[model samples]
Target: MSQHTPPSPVKKGKELILDITTAAFEGKGLGKVGEYAVFVKNTAPGDRVRVRINRKRKNYAEGVLLELLEPSPIRISPKCRHAGTCGGCTWQHIPYEKELVYKSGHVKDHFQRIGGFRDISTEPVIGAPEPFYYRNKMEYTFGDRRWLTDEEVQSGRDIADRDFALGLHVPGRYDRILNLEECHLQDPVSFRILDAVREYALANNIPPYNTHRHEGFLRNLIIRNAEHTGDLMVNLVTSGENDEIMQPFSSWLLERFPEITTVIHTINDTRSPSSEGRYQKVLYGPGYIREYLGPYHFRIDPNTFFQTNTHQARALYDVVLGALDKVPVLYDLYCGVGTLSVYLSGMATRVVGVEVHAGAVEKARENAAENGVSHAVFEQGDMKDIFNDDMIRRHGSPDIIVTDPPRAGMHESVIRQIISILPKKIIYVSCNSSTQARDVALLSEYYRLERIQPVDMFPRTYHIESVAVLSRNDT
Candidate 1:
């Protein structure tokens, strides 16, 4: 028998008016057109918008918001002037309360739909105390091509020098950059430095790096601020080392803002656009700055991976710490720089940290040593390879396992290993809920899902950090 399928209600390049009924994940708005779902960006619930369908699929379609016919009642003015254009903070226009609601709902929906869990215990989301200027780190790219906004084009103003931009990449366009006037994510001093750097580059006639040509004087600028310790670091990534340009620039910058604790110049001779360089030279101060999570202090290098949100990270770690009871031994999987491992060392007699990056492993060892944490040891290798019986025999079996894998989530082999070992409790901390739910589903038979605590680590964005507690089934 041949079955007939109906055609889609919307077509590409067609314009239609829709009343947004609800909010969806990734800062999208959902609306229906005769039983067909359409997704639009930069829209909120209770809004009527004119959308141009750009992508059409079998059941749903994606559109671009062309005009906002009616604004949502709950809509709030965004703090940043670059609100809708900048991709860093997508939900800035929506109220912070509504943003929290959407994030919590998304986590719950992922568990029910992806994990196939009919009934799940979920706690209320913990919102950040200070939503703006909470980021400890900010990365700005140097591009030769500048992206112009629609407003700028319509104004008919004489826009000069469309090249040499020092800001974030335009959404979905890697080669184009939007010259950022102001950003509310990092400290105000960081933006002041950014503007000063841009002025210096322009005055010195420094050309930005071209993605297509791969040749320029400026590459990227990275700033890291220690919230608790008040230490600041500035990392300048360039195509090559030029003492002629760097020496005077560093002196001028330091003279203007003496609060800069350290300055590093990194050289990236490769063609890749990554900010990480081949090697770095310390232009001023020590090569590293110190940060404090709680009572413990950590040395942060230019390339080290630390939590971006310094304030909210304490809240996120509190969730992980609250889920645990004292145990003889604990295993911290994917433990980068041993932050959580060292943090949780107080509750366990011995903690074994496993990470893939050797450099991170070395830093973890250093951090543990710096904090006088003698009971914690870090092993460098892939989780799937190192988490076998041999390693278990070397450093006694774990009573508890805490796994925090990347966005792709844990590998199936790691899941199988956890199931085989069958620890008493598993604390899974994840940044992506969909992948976390899938991993949880894999261990459904051996472990029972207890509850999940969602933390707003990065506010103004769709990203979330959650800690899922699972206990081994007694039966």
Candidate 2:
């Protein structure tokens, strides 16, 4: 809890030594300089290392690992070749089991420190069945140049400067690609799809997109393969319609691979380009892919937001269902595509799902009807505004409320609205534990935290998806 101090006068390029002391903000792993906490990367709570000051600030300092004179006991060698470069798995150096412990502790610590909550339990984190190659989706970029390590540059060979693809993207660099042979974070199917795409693009003389120049045939290659069901969706983001090129590629793909049910191409012809919300074109086969979860089948498009780990998603959803405890009337807020409601439609007497996206609401209705579910009703509107007295009177006040909010968690106004309704049982699923903890603290005035389960939805990463059930307490 120490504040950052001004850095001493040192050469800009000179390496300064510091002993790793404690954990800092965002679990960057902290080191100290004369009682001041210096946020350093790749070093844990207790470790000694020589870090070269990269950027000095009055508040904090950024440094690179010049030499690890002594490594921490918690540090483990990363398995992936592109671990540090890909910017995907930041905490891979930490041991697998230890990573869960640290992540869970990190969530609890943030809640206790920031959310003003004292009753939060630091329970054993629920880990994934398969730690490695568990991710069902991976988005690999197509870049012009590759980034090289110091060792490659010191070898007197232009290894990175050569014309090649740098597998995944670097942390901050938009155009620079980090060449990777294999990323263990994804399943073998992901690697296969990536390799095939890279080979096909290279052989066809297609150029990777240069974000700076805004030119090239290829932009992004996103692969999604479900674990429960072997459904594959490949989204190829390009500049514009290239049917002449995509026609043959599509044929070649479907001829050889039947797993790729959906092959899509999206066009982004704008000065300020983005991957989100752009209208995608269906090149071949179906426009969407289907993912089976227990009794429900989820149809996913390119832009749909589904959990990365399909295996653990079942566990997360099960926790939500368990919180309902067979309530007759249930309300699901922020129910994207009505996944939860669709999954629990059989158990509940009637389920009401509220969402913002009109298209998603339509899809949710279609999905529910497809599954022959007659007890579910969906409406497209703002959750806070739609939960009025009229709507409540029609749908009936929910005995159980299940909310899966975004990373920012529920807005203060929405929390107040929920408090006004005051359901018998509340199940909250959150991607950001800090925000969830804050909401829980606010709701603690009316409800008590019953059982909190931390599900490792994204393995090999520091993110945790937690489900907290709160029951109304008699004061």
Candidate 3:
């Protein structure tokens, strides 16, 4: 028997000139090196670049940008100084107008390539109003060791004196964190809070959390602010819960920022970067803050799931509501915190929102109450398991279903259950187009594609939020 051998690695230090066309699925510039697809990082469509081949495979290759021979006309200067190091805003270099074009192309590509949908019409992406400072929420990490610049390290700075750093993560480096002076994506107040908290922790000798050793005082700092309302929430996440230990810091924050409405402290013993806590307590004021979406007012908790971009979320919700007919009953499946369900409660006679997280359901109910939405109620259980005969009887049948699922999209079982229910309309909203396309393909058997609205919820990022409206197809 003959053994199959792996292809030889492309020689290192190899430079190539490539004419790029469109950005690939992985957010890299796609080019051809003699019929072989080569992905170059940080290059945009219409860019001609000199790149060095770093990795190669049987069918494709990856390159790193060495020099720009010709720059794309749509390219512009990024707002953030840390854009060179931080991974969050990759497309900031591209003009916002052109960014929308590429994002639209990416969505249509997903429907065609993944869902195998032919001639699917995609509307132009709804661009963000303000390209900068649109994010209402921002999280900064604490690191015991600071990631130094070429100048900083060469100047012979002592590691111990400048070791403690709290800022954004350096791309692809787990342990390294670049100290962010300012971030353009979030409000300027968030930067002030970041700096203040860092100074306080440094003076108090609070050690930054070390991911490798799993020991430290401070872990993460999260700031949430309202765009419409001036309400702000500051959440200090630590390794453990100690009221006395957090009392001084929380007191200082409230004293410093008179505008801060709420202060929260959460303890997470786990190693993951999640703010989902082992335990939490309200240090000052209420445990949550208020944010408005349309006429409804939502009380967002520390670990609560709220849309990051405040203004764009409302626009996306508007698109979601516009696609559907006024139905008697609405079912919001995989509903985290019931944002959409509450939004639909005004139009529908009865609204039922189902979520797996009990805490989120509690908050959802609170939201419904806050908005005086008496017609809406929340059900807490696994959708696939609880979405049976009894569950339907309890909540009544849904005339229209709106599912805003997680990035993994809906499970096969959930999809089948939804189809079995056979609602007149299905409004699918997703952050991940790839998984969404798969779910759409499954629903295509019973429902016909009606409208595709892609909203740019996250600007300057490769991510896209698309809404698909489906109507019943009676054969």
Order by TM-score, highest first: 1, 3, 2
Give TM-scores for every candidate, taking all chains together and pairing residue i with residue i.
0.98, 0.91, 0.92
Which scores greater on TM-score, model 1 or model 2? 1
Better of 1 and 3 by TM-score: 1
Q: lDDT order of candidates, best first?
A: 1, 3, 2
Clashing pairs in 3: none
Candidate 2 Cα outliers beyond 4 Å, as residue runs: 1-14, 21-27, 55-59, 160-166, 254-258, 276-278
Estimate the overall C-alpha local distance difference test score of candidate 2. Answer: 0.78
Error of model 1, residue 386, in angstroms: 1.3
Off by over 4 Å in 3: 1-13, 149-162, 241-245, 270-272
Compared with the true structure, model 3 gives a TM-score of 0.92
Candidate 2 lDDT over 70-107, as tens digits, reads 88887788887666557787677777787787778877
Among residues 3 or more apart in sequence or in different chains, the pairs in candidate 1 whose N, CA or C atoms overlap within 3 Å are none
* Candidate closest to the true structure, highest TM-score: 1
On lDDT, who's better, 1 or 3?
A: 1
Candidate with best lDDT: 1
lDDT of 3 by residue, 1-475 (tens): 8988654444456898888888876568899966678888788888999999988878888988888999987678778777756677878778888888888898898999999898997999999999889999998889887888665678896665467888888877978888777788888888899999988988888888999999997889999998888889899989997777799998898899989998989888898877766878888887888889998888787888899999999999999888767878998888889888888787689999999999899989988887888998888988878877787788878888999888999988888888778989999999998899999999998899888899998888888899999999972
